[model samples]
Target chain A: MFTDCSSSTTSRLIHLYNRNGVFLPRPSVSQFSLRTTASTWRCTLSIRSSSSPSAIVIDGKAEAKKIRDDIKIEVSRMKESIGVVPAEDSSEEEVLKYVSGFNDDPSVHGVLVQLPLPSHMDEQNILNAVSIEKDVDGFHPLNIGRLAMRGREPLFVPCTPKGCIELLHRYNIEFKGKRAVVIGRSNIVGMPAALLLQKEDATVSIIHSRTMNPEELTRQADILISAVGKPNMVRGSWIKPGAVLIDVGIKPVEDPSAAGGERLVGDICYVEASKIASAITPVPGGVGPMTIAMLISNTLTSAKRIHNFQ
Target chain B: MFTDCSSSTTSRLIHLYNRNGVFLPRPSVSQFSLRTTASTWRCTLSIRSSSSPSAIVIDGKAEAKKIRDDIKIEVSRMKESIGVVPAEDSSEEEVLKYVSGFNDDPSVHGVLVQLPLPSHMDEQNILNAVSIEKDVDGFHPLNIGRLAMRGREPLFVPCTPKGCIELLHRYNIEFKGKRAVVIGRSNIVGMPAALLLQKEDATVSIIHSRTMNPEELTRQADILISAVGKPNMVRGSWIKPGAVLIDVGIKPVEDPSAAGGERLVGDICYVEASKIASAITPVPGGVGPMTIAMLISNTLTSAKRIHNFQ
Candidate 1:
């Protein structure tokens, strides 16, 4: 069904949280956060791809962990310096109220509502409630509209798609004039990714379920980005030889050989595609980790913008 | 440049004004423009291509003129029935003030700020002032963002792009699975046209100035939509055989032969394109006329939505 890219199948793209990742400025964190600490950004250290010398294995897991750790340290340090405790958010309404308070608070530079909120609450309303200036996730329609429009800049870009582009930039992959195909059209990932690729001067084509010949269309791509969360849906045949593949799909599949009878896999058939694709991102360590790193990056950027720090 | 999709090279695609028929919604037009009295919308009476029987010539100019006439009749009739005279607006700030008043006045269905505002005013600030419900131009970021999104719908669509799609639909030109190429990335026409094409299930590609080999990209398209406003930039050689061409470029060109010493042209080489493609929209009679028609249509839709008169 995933191979079909069919209408019957629904896209499972959703933003995940690490319990504390969503609601930032947890009154427990310090107001003195983002205090002009000039540490090397250590964004990435390129490790040559095991499969191809031209490709690099992007270690997103390590980078994401470092960012989380960095944020934690900064929060603790700020708490010690500024000494402010965030009030408890006991309910969904309380969580929203807390977020609203942060919107006006100059100290709080970013705000985000984790996706898949307990079904009762309206997702659009919560995302809309975040002040445009503080909307670090960039889920707000205004931010997205700004991103899509020419001569307009969004305050923030959605993290996963941003991470995908960041990986390409960090890796020095040139996609100009190239036939780039983005699989899936979920608002958060595929659509924005296509826009980002276009911004980079790539000839972009979006492949969705309605596509009459998805395989034929995909095979023409010099840069193929697959975000449909169906494991191993893209085979080696679907990709052009030497094409750069950015696989944003992640889903748990049954595997008796693993410690748990389940293993995480991406949309692309990594084993076979590695032979044909010049470069490719692996499932567990791919766009997943970079997403969190990008969130922190956006938050830092917001703080810098708010404080007018270079 | 205005009629030939000429080689005169003047139109570099700057957003234009009423002087060239780009912006619609002249204030002299009555406020009760689109009173919905359901009659079969005489949208199109497609004329088969003189060059090819399979191709239908979309007469946008006649349709637009008819629409304007219809609107004039309805607006005049309604103004006579419900007596409310709209105040005149002269300055930029006054124009903004007038629009805001319309926004709050439930009687006023849609509001639009004509483009190419005078050099002194902040265009974005003025546009942001319009209420979302009343933003008939569909230029507002929120509306655009909704259009870009998968599960969201904009209250209105930008006219030119919407006209392009409506032509394809009204003419029964198939879009699904077609490799559609959109030239240019302007927010007003090109970007939205690309998005609308994608929504119609075409595997869409966008080509801009930075495109290394635009010809190569365009050759792959089954449907080519050019809105670059660069006079006759696209040659007959650039087109694929039997491709569907929708040229959105309109610029006035200097011509010594004409009495006025000038003529209208578009972005495509119409003479060349018409010979090569199975279907093509003429420079003056094509996308231009449909734009105004769409504005009146959008206004009518807005009125219907607001009044629930359907």
Candidate 2:
């Protein structure tokens, strides 16, 4: 998880804080605190995979790589067609350049950034900085605020949640009047996922850590999407038979039994839940692949709009 | 509702989006096919109160007045004690000044803006502009974001929801492990209120317009908070007898039989809900008073903090 991006920026601040007691205010520092303190170090990140083990891998990493390659090809094509350029510098700069270019190009339909960016970056600020026209991920506060309000539609949705809904759409899962429970409320995944589910006309309820008796509520869900990063936090007892389960959690678990003494798992106990639920997504290959696929879709849409392709 | 504040020298941006075609984008004109024919016209401003015999008066006008008076007294005292010049302009101005002042003054603690601001103004922009420190309403995005995350507390709770919870707290209602359903996910009321209930260890569910089978979920609520602006949206049949109800809506309903053509009403059918509910707040006298009282409390806290008072 410590990508090359993490070392260059926040390491400077950490070095300063260690050497000198005076900690200067950097927006990056607060984000770093949120990342290091909240997700990785404080809790167990992984668990065992499937006990039954018929599950297919989602392969988010491979999917993301495929999407990035497609985007690079499209960017070059746009240049060939109209002399427009996609930035080769920072992802933020590249996103801004495409969004800013939207004023002149009505054809450019989408713009998106890959998620799990370096923790030091302000996600919301960077997302909002994307011009509204090219906001393929639709993570901007304006888009989020619009999505939250009645009678408004976000131009684009965050990739992971969008992928979840697309899965339902592709599988022809009926959402109308269905009781749905979203077990997270992050701006990136759970919140938008719930909104999309509601847009599909499902009766949605959000249960977070503060929610008491989450299992009871989950047991009632005909459709459940769990994005709480906690590994195997959801038990088999929580599944409502015939319910469609989408597990978005991907945790790295340490186990001597597995390769390299570690393995990936999801929020739900796959063995038990799969037995009861009608359909369920596996940790590494299910929701993960869809996320990257949607990212590619969003980027292609953006490029099409930029090139004015009908 | 707008009022002249007791403060001075508060700079504010009064945004005007003319409904009379001042800034309708060119594309919208093309869609309407009235680009040349469109002409500006001054629209009549009216506060069209509702018309319902069973209306419950919310009394925002009285509540806001009382709050302002209380703030006036505190501002007078601060002047006497610290010689800090308190600004007086308008309701919007007062909120801005206090928020801006609170940002600089280490002593200031809490700040709030009275709700039902003039319809001409942009509510979200104004609310978002309030410094998070003094956001007593807790409507600011940053504060709301923090509240949504686990292990976080807002600087101040939204007064309306806080008042609703205070009623539950005072009445010895047990929400812990109890299922609570909040209708409406507005940033100011519903969303934050659900978060607050969850923080109290209640199993909380939020239902908005997009929710399907809202009535079915309402039946599951041991505690219900309805802030859906629709008057009498939550019927008695929807409520579970003995369930505690907090009606946060206060809409004016016009009645030719009454002295004025209009009177206040809540989102719940008060007569029906009161009969079924173990306890219920009267629209005019219950949550209304508590909200204003909390605002005063927040303002006093701000002043004390500015003065470094323990």
Q: Quick one: best DockQ, which candidate?
A: 1
**lDDT per residue (tens digit) for residues A153-199 in model 1:** 88789999999988887678897777799988888899999988988
lDDT accuracy of residue B25 in candidate 2: 17
What tens-digit string does per-residue lDDT give for candidate 2 at B68-103? Answer: 687788777877878763333446655555567666
- Please give the fraction of native interface contacts (Cα pairs under 8 Å between A and B) kept by each candidate: 0.69, 0.28
Which ten contiguous residues of candidate 2 chain B have the minimum total lDDT?
Answer: B37-46
Provide the global lDDT of candidate 2 against the true structure: 0.62
* Candidate 2 CAPRI assessment class: incorrect
Q: Give per-residue CA lDDT, model 1, range B224-297, as digits (tens).
A: 99986655557667889889899897766445554685566666666556666888788789888889788777
Writing each residue's lDDT as its tens digit, candidate 2 over A1-310 gives: 1212121111111111221332312122112111112112222222322344333333445545666677687777777887755333456555555456664566554567556455655567666666654555666654554565445665566888998887766667899768899987776898778767766767777776556557778888988999866555676677788888899977665444567866776777665566678877777877888887786677666556555654
Best by lDDT: 1
Please list the C-alpha lDDT of all candidates, in the order they appear: 0.68, 0.62
